[model samples]
Target: MDEHISEAIGRPDLIRLDDGLLCLRFETMKVVSALAAVSHLLDTGVVRRGDTLVDSSSGIYAYALALACHRYGMRCHIVGSTTVDHTLRTQLDILGAHLEQMPPSSSLKLDQNRRVDRVREILRENPDYHWMRQYHDDVHYLGYEAVAERIHARTGGGSLTLVGGVGSGASTGALTHYLGKRSVDVRLVGVQPYGSVTFGSGHVADPEIIIAGIGSSIPFGNVRHDLYDVLHWLAFDAALAGSVDLLRRHAVFAGLSTGAAYLAARWERREEPGRTVLFVAADTGHRYVDTVFARHQEAARVQDLAPRPVRGTHELTLPWSRMSWDGSPAPEGALLRSAAAGAGPGDGRRASKCQRSRAAGEGATSM
Candidate 1:
C-alpha cells in the first residue's frame, strides 16, 4: 500500500472514540474500495471503454466517481448541486469530468430532482451515456460492502454498533446487509440532520439540506429501512460542534455531515457498552472551514433552536406524523438511547443525556 494509505490503516489509537466505541472511520476505506471495485469491473469486462458514466453526486462521491472514471478511461458527466463545495467542483474539473450544476434557488432547500433531471436531459442528448445511479446502483453497494467486510474481518466478525449519515443510503444499507450476511451481530444506526427528510420525519420536511451531498431529500431506493436498527437525528449546530470537537481533540477535520455522524457515534457510545461503535467521518472538514468555522459567516444565520430529539419522553412528539419511506409509526422516547440500550455500548459506559431544550416552536433553518 502507498504510504498515505498505510498511515491511514496503521493508526490504532485513532480507532477508539472518547466513549470507548471503536470508530471504524470508513470514509477513506470506502473511497479506496470504490476505486478498486471499479477497477475490477473494468478488468472483468463489466464496464467497457468509451462508456459515458453519469451520476448525481454531492462533492465527495463526485470526486471519487470522477477519479474512477479517469482511471478506467471512461467519460464522466456529474450532475451536481449548485450548493456543492467549490473545491470539489475544481477537483472534478481537474479530473476532466463534465460538470453540470443545478438551477439557482434562493431557498436553502435543494431540489433532489434537479440532478435526476440533468441525468435524464444528458441521456436524452447523448444516447451512449450510462447513468451510474448511485442511489440504486448495485456497484455502489458492492463498494461499501467491501468496507463492512473489512470491519468485520478486523473485529473478528464480532458484534458492533455502526453509526453514520446517508447521502444515497448505499453505505448504511450495504454495510448492514454485508455484516448481517456474515452473521456478525451488528446494529446499523442512521443519522440525519434536523432539516433532512432522508431517514426520519422532522419539523423541517425539506428534501435536502445545504450540507451538500451527505443526505438526500428523497428516500433512496436502496435504504433497506429494516436493516437500520436505530436512527439518530442530529441538528446542524450539534453536528458543527461535534466537528469542532473532533478537530480539537483528535485533529480530525471533517465536514458538517461527518460531524453529524460523529455526534451520533458519541451518542451511541454514551448509551451502549460492550459493543464497538463504528461511525463514518463521511468527508474531510477542510471544505467547511468558511461555513462552519467562520464566526462572521456563522453570525449571519439566525440562532438554531431545534431540540435534539431523544427516543423516550412524550415531551416531544414525532417530528412527522408518518415516516417518509414507509408509513410505519415513528419511534417514541429517545431514539439514540433506545438503540444503545438494545445494542449495548462499548467497554466504557458513560451515560450522557441531551441537556438542550427543543426550539420554542416549529421552524426550519437552512442547513
Candidate 2:
C-alpha cells in the first residue's frame, strides 16, 4: 500500500485564534518523531533487519512508534500505560505492535516510571531490542526541524513566538532552537501543569489532571530552561476552559495541552500586539471526550473562556480570544523549586539525580 501515516505528520495546520495569534494545530502531528529517529538509526546502521524496536509511551508516542516500526518492517514492542484503552489496544494489535501495559498507577509520574521499568525488564529479556528513549533522546529533536523551517519560511523569519507544552523538550524546545538558528526571533512560551516539577512548579502530584503528554513530574533531560522566555503553569480547569473554547468558537477540536498553549498564545498576543504568535495542539479531541467535554460540571466552567486573575498563575487571559489582565511573580520563576528541599539555583541535588540516571546507562539524558 502506498498510504503511510508518516507521510502526513508535519507542517501542521495553522488557524487564526484571535486578532493576531494563530493555532499551529498538531493533534495529528504524530509519526514524525519515530520517522526521524528511525531514519537516522537506519542510515547509520545502528540496528538492522531482525532487530526489534522498543519504546515506552503514555499515548500518542506509542501509536507513532508502532506506525514507524510497521513502515520499516521492524518488530515493535510498546511499554504502555494503564490509560491505554480498548480502541487503541485494537489499533496496536492491527499494526502488529506488541504492547505490555503497566499496572494502574496513582499518578501520571508513577505510571510513567512503571512503564519505564517495564521497558527495562523487556530489554533485559531481549537485549537486542533497541530502546527508543523518546524522553531523553537528542535524535528526537531532528523531527521538528522541518516544522520550524516551514514556519520560518512562511513568516519570513520576522517577529514570532511559539507556545506549547514543554514535554520531553522535543517539540517546543527543538522548534525554538531550529527557528533561532535561522535568525528568527521565535520567543518560546513553555507550558506546564501547575503541579509538575518542570520550570519549578510545585511538586504536588495531581492524579486528577486529565491532561497527558505535557508537563513532567521529573526533570526532563532535554529541556533547556534558558531557551524558554516564559513559562505558564496551567491549571487543569484553565486548560479545559481553553479547550472547550477552541471547539466552540474555532471548531478546532484539540487536546488539553493545546488549550493551554492556545490560551497562553492569545494572552501573549494581547500583551504584545502586532506580533505573530503560534501554539501547538498536540492531539485531537477524541481522546479527551470522556474526561474533558463529557462531564456536565466541567462543561459549565467552560462557559467563561476569559482568563481571570489568580494568585499563582503564570499568566492570565480572557476567554480564548480576549485578555482581561495578566499576573506574574515579582521575581519571576528565577528560583524554581525542585523535588529536593529549597528553591533557587546553585544546587547539586538535581545534577546528582541526572548523574545517577546517566550512571544507569541512560545516555546522559534528563527525565
Winner by lDDT? 2
Can you write out model 1's per-residue Cα lDDT over 1-367, one digit (the tens) per residue? Answer: 5433323432222376555565555334336434654666677776687787776765566666677777668888887766666777887888799888777666434455656666677777886676665554345566655576677777787668777775555566566766877788877777765544444443443333435555544434333444555666655565666677677667776777777677667666666777778887766666678667663234222123233445532222322111122212223221222121111111111122211111111111111
List, residue by residue over 1-367, the lDDT tens digit for candidate 2. Answer: 4466565764477677676677777655657667888878888998885579888777688888887888788888887788788888899999999988778887766776676677777778888888887765567777888888888877778889788987776788778777877888777777777565555454433445735677665555545555666766667777877888778878898888887887787777877887789888878889889888775255534434444444433443322222221222212232222312221112211221221111123421112
- Which parts of model 1 have CA positions greater than 4 angstroms off? 1-14, 26-46, 108-110, 202-210, 295-367
Collision pairs in model 2 = 27-282, 27-283, 221-366, 305-319, 306-318, 306-319, 307-317, 307-318, 307-319
The TM-score leader among the candidates is 2
lDDT of each: 0.55, 0.67
> Distance from true position, residue 26, model 2, in Å?
2.2
Return the lDDT, model 2, position 68.
84
Task: Tell how far residue 366 is off in model 1, in angstroms.
Answer: 19
